[model samples]
Target: MSEAVLETRDLNKNFGALQVSRNINFRLDAGARHALIGPNGAGKTTFVNLLTGVLSPTDGAVLLNGRDITHMRQDRRVKAGIARTFQINTLFAGLTVLENLYLAVSEHLGRAGAMFRPAGARREVVDEAMAALDGLRLADDAGKTIRELPYGRQRLVEIAIALALKPKVLLLDEPAAGVPSAESHLILDVIEALPEDIAVLIIEHDMDVVFRFAREITVLVQGGILASGPPDEIAANAEVRSVYLGEGTHD
Candidate 1:
């Protein structure tokens, strides 16, 4: 079994009297394909923000490979091998795919601001960017602007840019949102094809995508864990069925 590379221990979060996340403990092992799902006001977004260091928890610790990082800064978390994508596409619409990827790769390599880098380093950065695009099956459109691509492909490019960060853990937030059914296959393919060394967590409301992508699922309701287990078990869970699966979740 793989070791738990990312974890939260008895975590809690509050906005004044609103307790959004409470006493939450979660773990993600190497190459773990985990999903977090719930209804509209379930605090799912709050919990994820805490995990990514975008928001501080009221209590408990965030750990990476057993090291405590409860107070780590956002950029530091990224450098520590945690990366995430949002529900919406955040790519530079005017930039070509290659340019976009090159920026991320260069930033990861610490050559983003180098006005005079050796030719060898530049070549390496270019190669890394190309590899990331190729991995996403997006090499053919490397020269195309983000505006020229479909929403789904743009989403994949965002993920590819995250991959360029060479993260050990990846968190994807609603990757298939706004994507047409026809184009969703592309996103699903790239997500499933991600490297096995990276632990991945997905936050999505699309039942079809979530049920198909996650081996294990975590159900959240009113700031607490309702159920967590394998896909079949989650599907069979009584509370999940009555509260979320029946109405809120969708294909």
Candidate 2:
């Protein structure tokens, strides 16, 4: 296989006596469409935290393009080509969608300090932000405040913000959470259309979405990997079904 864009080796995390991640040995290759799924308390969020440096592991290391980044700061990790969206919408409710995207694009360009200037004065920033929005077919909503958009569109804006950072790896935490079923397909469609060179990892509870978007699936049970393989293999695995899918568990 090609070198992984992101990797975790023997990763472990502990809160006193309770372990949240257990010797995780995982890899995300460039352009990988991977899903991490399991029941509640399976430590999916904690594992993402470890990768993004929101939480440090008790042992092991996180690597990006073969460089050790376990000790990297969270913001530093983002600057180093890893970007993520939370399970909850994190957009600035009062800001226009374009404005929110402008913040991210400018920050990525190291020009956030100058963003207070009129957008006309920062043409490049505005152009890039609009391009990001346009790529996601959200240009029409650019003038609307985040709160003015529907929840599903709000989630799409969150993704646009992440993409504005030009990340090599994008980690999406429950991108479709709270979206109406009728609109949830929009989320999957957008994900499926993401740039092929950007590795994507999604932590989701919807089985239909998982099966549709993931080329590979990893089942995390009680903070450790119970299974990792192609979607068909994972779908057919008895343990994964019994512990997660069959039980209709949500995380």
How accurate locally is residue 89 in candidate 1, as Cα lDDT from 0 to 100?
Answer: 91
For all candidates in order, the CA lDDT equals 0.90, 0.93
Clashing pairs in 2: none
**Using Cα atoms with residue i matched to residue i, what is each candidate's TM-score against the true structure?**
0.92, 0.95
Name every residue pair that clashes in candidate 1.
Answer: none
RMSD of each: 2.1, 1.9
- Please write out the lDDT profile of model 1 over residues 1-251, one tens digit for every residue: 66899999999998999999988999898899999999988998788789889999999999999999999998789889998888889888898999999888887887877887753367889999999998888999999999999888899998999899999999998888899999988889888888888999999988888988898899999999999999999999988998999876443
Clashes of each: 0, 0
Off by over 4 Å in 2: 115-120, 249-251
| Global fold similarity of model 1 (TM-score) | 0.92
